[model samples]
Target: MGAVRVVLVGGHESADGADLAPVVQQLPEAAVSTPGRSLLSQVRAALAGSDAPVVVLPMTWGRDPVMIAETARTLRWVAGGDAHGRVALSEPFGTTDHLIALLRTAATRTATRWPGSGLVVSAPRASPFDDAELHRVAHLVRVHGAGLEIGVACVGEPADLTLAVDRVRALRPGHVAVVPAGFATACPEADALADVDFVGPLMTTSAVLRVVRERTAGALHDLGHGHDGIAAGLDADHGHGYAHSHGPDGDHTHTHGDHAHAHAPHAPHPDPHATSHASALG
Candidate 1:
């Protein structure tokens, strides 16, 4: 049996983001395949080429149910062959504890940059689970980010942002800094509002990279070896190309959080931004 190999798979949209390169660079042993092609295509390539068991860590915020489900189907299709059953998909990177820390750092910088400004954390509003994750981030900010007013907004709809802006402005803030809950810098959805500053996305921070490394390590130990049965246990009838339902009895997933982090620059950078979203209003 060959040694286990870890690979980080990101959405195809972040193909050219220079910040993401550090993850692969930092972990010389791990291979990272970014989105441009399909997620299934990247997973297949990694598994087929590696000699050892493969653990794929999807570098996304929140465990995107669609992407997670697709990964299972992709592995079952590619790894079912005579490759010694050595392919596994780890849960998404959003589970990391460092991310909330990073969010605090980002929000703090935003507040400090503008001085006495309230914070509006923004997300794309993809699914109900996504919304829950955004709410979780909001809770984190409210607890750790004392002296700062926090507002959550789903950027997908106009009314949500409008309401969030009104509420945030009501705090008599110096300004409003919009931080991406996942990995976003400039959210046009919020940009339309006046006196709003955009904070850089969280995809490229050292803290985030460390979290990826930790998750890959955990998945390799927890779900990598002899876990094909768990992956294959998904229900066939689940919709949206899902290989399994999200039920606890058969769901093979893991989540991570509760750690510390260091601060980084909050200046917005232009690149292929992160596609993972925690969206819709609440």
Candidate 2:
């Protein structure tokens, strides 16, 4: 069978040099598409001349449902307002379960490097569910004796980096290491904390690349065999039940089972050359 074209749908920051570049360079026949950018144009381009399917792997840690929804919407549009039979979304690069496993190892390493140090796992503020998941991850790490104690922090929410560090500091450990989750870059504000060590982003790791390659291979195989692969499951399971705060607009909630809502309209795709150079993703 011919090689399937692989397109990575990354977060808003995925286009940044330090985040997705290394991994993309390592993969063969993979391109990137991000929302509000050239996601439409690039995926269209990927499907233009190829009968083989284009598999889209969302580069999320399963914390950002909006990104996932948005990618699904874009894929549908690229498929001409229909189900994406030609273009398919594979499983996310890293699920919440994967994050827990990755952070467990990181916690162990941090504890070994700095004995008795409290650990802090931080990610960009996504949702209440996201916050809860981080806390759960911290609890599991502590329960597993991966660290002396662990704390949770979100980049933009109330439990910001400093506040989470303070919560950990209340334990009076030997030192502290703030481990970032979700993306490849450490929290930008991590440097302001005195005497605290910051770990690198997990997106740059070999495990992540391996996951991407595996997801791509599976999607390609499914397409070759007349199955839709993960995209079929995603379409059936797209209903998400969660509440997200929208600044002063207050929180909007959605329940499980058939639900409908509107997303902010996106501008139409630009011309080909401009689409080729758009930086948000594709």
TM-score for each model: 0.61, 0.73
Q: Which candidate is the best by TM-score?
A: 2
What TM-score does candidate 1 reach? Answer: 0.61
lDDT of 1 by residue, 241-280 (tens): 2233434444233221222232234422222223343331
Error of 1 at 35 (Å): 11
Clashes of each: 5, 0
The 10 consecutive residues of candidate 2 with the worst lDDT sum are 273-282
- List pairs with backbone clashes in candidate 2: none
What is the C-alpha lDDT profile of model 2 across 114-225, one tens digit per residue? 8788888876665665566667667876787564788888667534888888888898645778887766565657777787888766545566677777877777667657
Superposed on all Cα atoms, the candidates' RMSDs to the truth, in angstroms, are: 12.3, 10.8
Error of 2 at 266 (Å): 40
Worst 10 residues of 1 by lDDT: 233-242
